[model samples]
Target: MTTLEDVLALVAIDSVSTNESALAKYVYEHLIVNSDLEVERIGDNVIARSVGLHSFRVLVAGHLDTVPGDVTASVIEGDVLHGLGACDMKGSLAGMIDLALDKTPRPVEVTWVFYAREEISRSQSGLLEIAELRPDLLVADVAVLAEPTGGRVEAGCQGTLRIKITLGGARAHTARPFTGRNAIHRLGDLLSFVALYQPREVQLEGVTYVEQLQAVSVEGGVAPNVVPDVASCVLNHRVAPDRTLDQAVQWLRDFLGELLDEQDVVEVKDWAPSASPELMNPHLTRLVEISGETPQAKVGWTDVATFREFGIPATNFGAGDPLRAHRSDEYVTTDEVNRFASVLGEWLRSTPNTSGTSI
Candidate 1:
């Protein structure tokens, strides 16, 4: 029966994703004090596990890292709790901790992973590092990521690829432009194409996942007085799971025909493909039933994809508006926090026990 006060108290400290040691220590201490869970740490990531009949394993995960932003003001309105990580995940983490503490006569074994480095690039995510060491430790029948879902189950995430498009040209003096081709000028038509291009919205596994391609950055101009020799634009593509990385690359090539040398269009980044929602699991189905909301697709990529790499299905379920997550006025409804916590507590209470028992 830990209160939101307990949750807010933790939030009061600045636990930006880059510096998660303090928060990890706090969570580690709290889990040790309130529950009979075995705790361990890898860098700043914290994991606490409790055994219950060893029938089936359930992993509850939430990143303790808050995106870098305002942390000086932590406020709680009538129903809203405002702070850096309030909605993006801290609320759900608090609820999970509360649920773990009230786990007397627990129904199923639960593992809590407060992984670090989730806000930045995936390569540095602590979850992935842990997966390499003890992959079986995270093996579970079901995993729920307490990422903000506005109380709905955000099944899975889309995959992303970042490509560098190099537009090559020879340099020449501005006064005698005929001597060399202007690489910057060559980029105009392609930029226009990108501006007017419409991304596709395809349906997968009964969910509509949208695809997007955009030029995130462009650089090549040498000087205003001279015709720039080489120009390059980095196109970041966020593709739906309907297409593989190969398909996505081919699609890009087709769209940007001859804009850059085919060989120069290299894939600078390749994340593992995304996983479709494991909505068919009975416990997950029951969770959706009790929450009384239809599930939806997550547009942005998340650590859930990292877990998917380990053959574990994951989903995002939590409270608060995701748009406000990294913004200055970040906030979450206290009521939403209370409701989400209660629903999780009830679901954990109802899990079946050993001897193939049903609660």
Candidate 2:
């Protein structure tokens, strides 16, 4: 089948966040039947590897699950495939499958990973599942995460720090709100501070990563006629590679020091650390050279960070526009998928200098 056909076929299968069993089974069967590589299935994750005893190994990976969406409504118009996961990932998954099935000899050994649960929390990541269950499968000199970069080398990813801040107040009648502190009223100043935040840009390996802060959710209400005693707001901060999660949290505390009261409570809800741009690595530098476009920092979080935790220098490179991911109108073009496949296939076939001077 053609690459576009493969993308449509995969999109037709519903693999939303926690519902990836059928798609995982399909991928497992396809790899087992079409490829001579060693295939393994851990939960919903499928891994295929070519153990050619080469000095260098390259790992290509893409998540199997997408955020919840209607799959039956997916369609193709002209040369574009429109669907929920078409752009965010299915397009690149198709390319990875084709490359995995290719019998052509390459200078480096290859490992292809199609994992589930990437669209959800980091703790439930299928990549992390593989890392914990079978770290040996992830051993590689260099890695590439197929994360909808519009066929460019999106180097490194921004870390995410989610925290919930609760303000203390006293319950009182709505008419006598002046008798008690209005917890909800405290949100205005904090939100205004977040709204006026200036994104900090940090340069790493010639790539500029911009940081962001936003208030995603707020909670604090007892009843329509009563003043609430507690109010909480969830703040999400996108951090650069220069800061660790601890440092980012500390920075947030410092930023809000003046606005927070002594009784206010700050709690970390979730966090995922960032990865630095590994363009200095010869394999990644070669990938940047082959794409014929300057590398850009990935502003959002991706499994590339997870790969970095495994000591694998990885970058995001794939089909489709990342800006369109998770949207109802997401799409992937035939040219985008073809270009991704060509560049990645060529990278696999050619040998890097390993002198770390390619960039």
Off by over 4 Å in 2: 355-359
Global CA lDDT computed for model 1: 0.77
User: Which candidate gets the maximum TM-score versus the true structure?
Assistant: 2
Q: In model 1, where do residues sit more than 4 Å from their true spots?
A: 261-264, 270-272, 352-359
Model 1 scores worst on lDDT over the 10 consecutive residues at 350-359
Error of 2 at 212 (Å): 0.7
Residue range 29-59, candidate 2, lDDT tens digits: 8899754599999999999999777888899
lDDT of 2 at 37: 95
Task: Kindly list the per-residue Cα lDDT of model 1 for residues 228-316, writing each as its tens digit.
Answer: 87787888788887788888888888887776664344556555566676666567767777778888888778777777776676777
Cα-based lDDT at residue 281, candidate 2: 84
lDDT of 2: 0.91
